[model samples]
Target: MQSAIETARKQLPKIRIELVDCYTGSAAQALIALTAARAVKLGDNLNQIIPKVNKVIPEAEITLVLDTLKYLERGGRAPKIGAWATSLLKIKPVVTNRMGHAHFLGMARSRTQGIERMIRTMRGKIGLNRVSAIIIHSELETEAKELEHRLRSEFNCNETYVTEISAVVAVHLGPGAIGIAFLPS
Candidate 1:
């Protein structure tokens, strides 16, 4: 997985693949594109985020990515705060690596709602005024398309894409799961 990410980073200098190193249920696929690089006269925050993965498993890394809370609950990884919040606040968090560890970016509600929440965060953090999009899903093509459409429309993006969550992530997120990735203007 790390090697593939390195290759993608090199080929798409602007793109970086950041695998979700958290608990999930996406165990169907074994290959996932971490990022798609873009040409740039200057590097942006999203570009800055394209560092190579620091670690790799001895056997392999799963392709699809799944939601975390459920797996965390089953595995006793995440605490009651995130689980309780999921039910009480309907918060679906975007998981990201923090200093080689998985941390919750923020809370979101539904799938599209979560993507919308991430869009807001991406706009503020990366200033994605003009950029393409990608949607990673879990056997949910219809939802993925709708999500892509919404993202394209709301962000005025040139491209919106989707991919199934990797086997690693799906093992945690369960069946119905999805996510979106993109860069800045």
Candidate 2:
């Protein structure tokens, strides 16, 4: 990113370019981007927006429930043996972002159980604080909507969004993957 920024600066000396690594991906990254955009919309200059974006980098978090570990094994993100074991037991893997990497949380025997674990994780993180959240899924709109409803009902959410996971991310998570990204406001 720095290289790209330098290259662009040479071509357009008057233009300003800033890059921020949110230390996370998927919906968490989206939330960080939204923070900067909101700051800009409120008439904040680049300097002001950078600080706001940085402040959110640590606060934002994402948790995912994958239907299977096949895709992760295929992508070389998981060991073949682990994937096979998970498949054999029919367990959904629960994952969360920590220090910019996907960290395994636990496993659920069913999708509904996985979603409940996700909600519990979020509740533990934010407690009664108001939050902003995004519920993301891959080819699972109905489940995503249900997750959204559950989140709103259980938490003090100031804003909530439901969205389809990007195709690039879905390629690795595969179908039936559901995730939630939240920021305590």
Candidate 3:
């Protein structure tokens, strides 16, 4: 079935959309994330850095090719304890922005479990009922569809879609990455 982003793009007017840089890997995520910024270094240099960081944040609003935390573990950014624990349990961590950096949200033991986690996160933050539009991107359509399904089933967001990740974006996510980006209402 078509996704909410697909339908929205096909049926509604375009907003002069532009596909910019994509971010992946925890180091890059740590460098680019703006979700939960603490000024530890920044705070000390607040008077100096705040202005500089602000100028960078909007442009740094990177399209994170969100990935399963395993890749991050292999990259050596994730804590060994969490990685080992998840591996022992066959769990996948749901990653998202933390202080504008990439961090773990929760664990998903399976694909369906991941979708529920994703949908719950989106719904809680943006509200399934009032979602403005969605950008459903993935390394493969089959997996991407699950995200579309969640949006459609929960929010009537039939406009969702599946699109290929760019080469630059792929560099970080590698293959088989599925990313869903939503604009805040």
Candidate 4:
């Protein structure tokens, strides 16, 4: 991004271009972008928008539950033995992105359990604060909606969205992956 910004600057020296790293991917990244967009729509200039976006970076959190670990193993993100064991045990792997890295939270025997774990983690982080959230899934819209409903009832929601994971993200997470990205206000 910096390289591209530099190249563009060479041609349009007076124009301003900046990149903000959300340090997370998927719905978390989208939430940051939405915050910036909302600021812009409210007539904030580049300077003001940048600060608002920066403030949201640390506040944003993402948690995901994968139906299987085979995709991670295939992508070289996990060990083959671990994926094999998860499959053999029918465990759903729960993970969260923190400081730009995916961290394993725990394992669940079912999707319901995984979703419950996600909500519990969010509650621990957010308490009673009002939250803005995005629920993302890979070929699992029904599950995503259910998660969204749960979130709305469990927290004071400022806004909520449901979306399918992008193909690039889906490639790594694989099908049947569901997750949430949230920011507490």
- Which structure among the candidates has the greatest TM-score? 2
Q: List TM-scores for all candidates, in order.
A: 0.53, 0.95, 0.52, 0.94
Output the TM-score of candidate 3.
0.52
Candidate 2 overall lDDT versus native: 0.91
Measured over all alpha carbons after superposition, the RMSD of each candidate to the real structure, in angstroms, is 9.7, 1.3, 14.2, 1.4
Candidate 4 per-residue lDDT, tens place, 1-185, comes to 77888999999999888878889888898888998999999999999999999998998999999999989899999889979988899999999997598899999999889999999999999899999999999999988998898899989999999999899888988998999899976
Q: In model 3, how large is the Cα lDDT of residue 62?
A: 21
lDDT of 3 by residue, 1-185 (tens): 24755666677665332222323333223332332254444454445445544443342212333445455556666777775776678665666653356656677767566656766666666564444333344456777776666666777453444566666545545455555554332
- Candidate 2, residues 1-185, lDDT tens digits: the string is 78888999999999888778889988898888989888989999999999999988999999999999899899998889878988999999999995498789999999999998999999999999999999999989998998898888999999999999898888888999999999988
Candidate 1, 103: how far from true, in Å?
3.3
- Winner of 2 and 4 under TM-score: 2
Over 4 Å off, model 4: none
At residue 165, give the lDDT of candidate 4.
88
